[model samples]
Target: MNYTLHQLQVFLKVTETKSITKAAEQLYLTQPAVSIQLRNFQDQFDIPLTEVVGRQLYVTEFGMEIARAAQNILNEVQAINYKTMAYKGKLSGKLSITSVSTGKYVIPFLLADFLKQHTEVELVLDVTNKNRVVRSLENNEVDFALVSLFPDLSVQSIPLMENQLVLVANRDFPMPKKPLTLEAIQALPLIYREAGSGSRFVMERFLNQLDSKGTKKMELTGNEAVKQAIMAGLGCSIMPVIGIKNELQNGDVQIIPAEGLPQSSQWNMIWMKSKNLSPVAEAYKNYLLENKSTIIQNHFGWTEQL
Candidate 1:
């Protein structure tokens, strides 16, 4: 009745994919290795865990039940490792964050140092649209959220860095011979991010504030797609400078030097007011609060000049 954790892992993987070959590929082991582990794991149990018929692999009902138990064992093992690291006076736990799509450019830089310092901590950064990010935060599904659009939600935030959405177009697009004005920029066809995106929300706010009547071209989800659309001469868009730095530098796009832009907002690290923070989460928040300015100055000093 002796089966190793490796055996259990192989067993679970086989059950998941219903193929020893697939389990081997996913586990980065040879097929023979996986086969051996599976055989060793199954030797202790009399009931069959899997079956193969007509050249197809299948997990039996009992195999599915054992897979659940194996998953629980893996989970407990992970928890024990975190607890042991904490026992050694190291901050060890999960630091989960849900960030708006554009926040992808910023969140990783913010986390890089903290993760390096606390090697025992596990990080999960989920990048999605503003609605999902806010939903994850409000549902207490994550320790923190990175977002720009602060709707009417009961949350507290720590402002991290300046986020500016600027009007940009393909380098080959037509530009006014005169000064770049709101009217001039708005006269061009425009591309937009999807409705519930933080970028779109801010873009709408700026346009509404200026009473713009620009022709709307099309809407795309995610910053990269919008950037690509603009580069392909599809249309112009107001995009976060952070997400377009590479494109701007490569001459793929050009920023319109319109007054009152780049429309500015602070990238905020937000959390529900009543949620209790774990040690890892608290340490990360404090690290940002204390070192965010330094990190920005070091990695993003160029952003200040922009």
Candidate 2:
């Protein structure tokens, strides 16, 4: 009962890292300071929260239960702070969004005006692969997920804009001497986004529909890595033009003109339908729905030429 939030924070960090030394480094405190706080916190509990065996720190089962409760307390404290700010007439709260890696190209532009209007809002964006982004949404770890692919999940969507995927290769790659055939294009070295990527899923589906089950010569985790690989002439890949606009314009890469190329999908903002949106989340959702037309016109209208 005498424990402070800082002690709880220190204790939680220790539990997470399983080492007071690491926790101190992460928390930016000296080892002795962390040890003092940890000792002080454990004194409040009836049972020992942590133990050392063979130089390794371990949190006891009671420690885990305490840590869970501590997390809830911290979450409540954050919620109270957000509420206090709202009452002062400045739209403020944490706005956490996870986007598939390629979405880095688009989400920020969409967020600019809204954030400008509500400067007090805290923004946390995680740009990872689609699978991770969806996992965050499934666990309700994020308020919204920006994705181009809508898979089998219980989620609602707000259509934002068109996404264009095109076949591209290093600018120095030899132009096919004749009009390209799917087989001929498939014969060339090809790179792919790693498995579990939304872009890869779409690309694979598009290729399957064409009956061209081409094997990738190499696979990379992100758009930037794949871009660099292909630009280094490792192979060609079907990449979102959103991610490759600079390369496309700079002539570092060239689009491979082929039939059924430039596959299209819509980038959407999706969230769990069963969950209630917080004030900040709801406000952002409405802002996106209301301004998507302008956003698309300004940011993505160039995809039309492809």
lDDT for each candidate structure? 0.85, 0.88
* TM-score (C-alpha) between model 1 and the true structure: 0.74
Tell me the lDDT of model 2 at 104.
Answer: 94
Cα lDDT tens digits, model 2, 100-162, are 889999989989999999999999899888778878988888999898989578999998887
Give the TM-score comparing model 2 with the true structure, all chains together. 0.89
Q: Candidate 2 regions off by >4 Å? A: 13-36, 51-58, 176-179, 210-212
Give the C-alpha lDDT of model 1.
0.85
Best by TM-score: 2
